[model samples]
Target chain A: MRLELGKIFIKDVQFSDETRVENGILYINKEELLKEVSGDERLRSIDVELAKPGEEVRIIPVKDVIEPRVKVEGKGGIFPGFISKVDTVGSGRTHVLKGAAVVTTGKIVGFQEGIIDMTGEGAKYTPFSKTNNIVLVCEPVDNLPQHEHEEAVRMVGFKAACYLGRAGKNVEPDEIKVYETLPLLEQVNMYPHLPKVVYVYMLQSQGLLHDTYVYGVDAKKIIPTFIYPTEVFDGAIVSGNCVSACDKNPTYVHMNNPIIEDLYERHGKDINFIGCIITNENVYLADKERSSNYTAKLVEFLGADAAIISEEGFGNPDADLVMNCNKIEEKGIKTVLVTDEYAGRDGASQSLADSTPKGDAVVTAGNANELILLPPMKKIIGHVEAADIIAGGFAGSLREDGSIEAEIQVITGATSEVGFGYLSAKGF
Target chain B: MKLKPVILTNNPLTKSSLENKYSVLYKKEASLLDILMFARDYVHKGHRLLTHPLMGSIKPNQTPFKSVAVSKECFNDVDLLSLEIIEESILKAEQLIKSKKTPVYTDKVLEDFSLIDFDLIKNALN
Candidate 1:
């Protein structure tokens, strides 16, 4: 598989009479974008706002953040199976609005939705704080179910992303990055001297609010499977899970998995970089055992000498992580686990609910339970009262002056388990 | 159901502590029967213990032990009991034995012992 990622660097996003990309600026006609996303009758009102880097704006109860990318010359379009027809993507050419993002915010679906601050102390934690964000605030009709509201907001984000992606259809790319991976046998033959490695990618599939989709199929029903490294880049997997705000792999992180990118950088050099085996973090004990067993079996069958397993969400999923690590290492395969901590507010409790001695090589993505104070932004994009009930928040989370005093878990991507963010924890 | 001894303890135990003890006993090449004997002695000393089928013995402090144990029995018809279940069942039995709300487990509670997941004993019998 081969992919040529064309980067269209977007420096600023502003509302204009016409929606187009000009000289690194993305112009959006708010009315047109609103109409495109407000097709669902469930939504009472749709408002589009531009939030650029260094802006004094805060987007709370954020559902998902997506990068605008068009499949310029690919087998399938961006967001395959959701907005686009399901075709085998991850090959050929694709153009990305590199510095621009579509941030979905609306009535809080679950207490787990996140907060993205464009600037100020809160900006330092989230990667979306840097992107030129096109904020979509969709208010649902009264008395709508939580699941329906989430689905409406999630679909709108994808729709808006696809719409913005069209602006780069004709624009020439600033730079193109080429990534290729040969078939399993050919790849092995090419890098026989290097140690063969596989990535055990765990998806949060604890159903209801916590779900992930692969080619429009619910991930919870799918057993352990293998996918080409580039498939994710083409939007093969998307997050619908509303886990804790800090660690859940949002759609943006799914599209740009740092582990895959970093593994590719070391591919053919330090390691063989075999393809990825994706498994689920199911709530059922049988499913956990079966998925971990299948994942380890597949890694062993792939002839991988080592593997890096990345987890999504904390708590019950920690059991899945340890199971994967222990089973893989039992096959004489070296394993490295990537996960974040939930060691309470003081970072003193156990980081994970589960533990195994086999998880020796582990990378912590920092503690989600650490407390932080977010000063009031000049403009609030979504419902401000939601801060009081959101997952990492207490009764007094939303202060009288509009400031927020809560755990870092309320902030989006503060403790990304995929090594997406820079925050990390160390024992004092 | 065959008579299977369940150790009920006053204090909850962490999985790490249980795992550490298991590792030590495992390094000494303790057999399943030997581990059960040790658990019996531990229970006699008033410490909680639960033996699982696949997960070995878990302390049950952190996990959803009560739900896992109940579901295992309801679905599999097995006696894969944990320490938490034994404690709860014993408490309930003691309440019956004393004919009061508060549990006062005398030797009467032991006489009326019933395992949670009967499958463990059934499989052993088979």
Candidate 2:
């Protein structure tokens, strides 16, 4: 499969009377984009705001962040399963609104929604702070259940992104990068001398705000399966998890999975990038055992000499990580595991819930439990009071002065397990 | 409910050592709640246990002991309590104990207590 990613570098974003991209600036027609997302009756009100890099703006209780992309020459549209029809994508040209993002925030969907600070010390920790964000603050109808609210906001974000993506349809791309991976047998045959490598991508699917969708199917229902490395670029997977904000792979991360990109960078040169084996992190022990067993079998079946395993969220999924590592290594396949830590507030607690001697090559994505104070921003986009109840936040998290004292877990993509951000942890 | 005598140890000893020193003394079947209640009483009697900065010493009165003084390496085969299970058990036990009734520790609760979810219960032993 081959994917041509045409990047249109967005220097800035602003609301104007018409929605269009010109001179590297994205001008969004607020009323038009609002019309696209307002179709959902679940939302009581929807407002769009612009938050640029280096601004003193804070988007709280952010549900998801997505980069706007439009399928130009693809077999299917972007976001194959959810926003677009359930079609096999990832073999064509797609245009990206590079450096711009759609940030969905509103009333708290669950205790796991995150905060994206545009500037200050907090900005350094989150990748979203660098993007020119089109912040969607959508409030659901009164007394809506958290699950329903999460679903509503999640879909709205996609709609807004898709709507904004249309702005890049006819515009010429600033740069075009092509990525391809042949069939497993062909790939191995072409790069016979190179070591065959596979990527074991774990999705959080523990149910109720901890779920990921593959072609719009709930991930928990699916077993381990193989996908082309390029398919992820076309949005083969979407995150539904509201887990700890720091580690959860939001939609943007899913679209631009760093492990896949990095591995592709060295493909055929250092290693034969076979493909990706996607699996779920189900809560049940039997499911965990089955998924890990199938993942190992798949990697072995692919004749992979080595593999990289990445996890989403933490805690319960740690078992899955260890199992994947141990099982794959038991089959003589060298594995490198990527994950974040919850080493308590002081960074002195055990990093993971599970461990095995076989997990020798591991990449830590920083400690999510480390405490940090986010100074008050000049303007707040969403509800600031959510800081008191969100996961990784305590009762006194939001002080009267508007500053927040909370763990890094409250910040979006602060410790992305996929190596999306530069933050990482080390042994003292 | 007749309570069994429980021992609280603060030594940097393995689970086997703690068991060898105290398990025999409290051999009678007792739920974790019973042991925690005893620990609270022991602390009330002016005993102090070493505590870690992140994970403080376990206080009997505080159900779902946030931080315990034992080191992570010392938790081998001890059925150490995780925060999730401890919190759940404490909520149930408090209701029962408040009514002056013996809390029935079900197999599910016991299993949760025995199997620690390390991710959810990090720094359990500082």
lDDT of 2 at A215: 88
Clashing pairs for model 1 are: B78-B117, B78-B118, B78-B119, B79-B117, B79-B118, B79-B119, B80-B117
How far off is residue A393 in model 1, in Å? 1.3
Interface RMSD, all candidates in order, equals 14.8, 14.6
Model 1, residue B79: distance off in Å is 8.5
Query: Considering every candidate listed, which one attains the maximal lDDT?
Result: 2
Cα lDDT of model 2 by residue, B19-79, tens digit = 5433312323443355444444433343322221111101121112121222222222332
Extract clashing residue pairs from model 2. A353-B119
Best by TM-score: 1
Return the TM-score for candidate 2, rounded to 2 decimals: 0.79
Off by over 4 Å in 1: A425-428, B1-69, B72-126
lDDT of 1 by residue, B52-91 (tens): 2222111121111121111211222223223322333333
Worst 10-residue stretch by lDDT in candidate 2 chain A? A104-113
DockQ of each: 0.03, 0.04
For every candidate, the chain B TM-score is: 0.24, 0.33
lDDT of 2 by residue, A1-428 (tens): 88999999999998899999999999999999999988888889999989999999999988889889999996988887788897889898999999999999876433335999999988999999999999998888887766688899889888888899999999999999999999878889998999999999999876656778998998988989999978888778888776578899999999999999999999979998999999987654456678999999999999999999999875457777888998999999999999987665566655765677899888989987678999999999988877776656665678999999887878999999999987875562
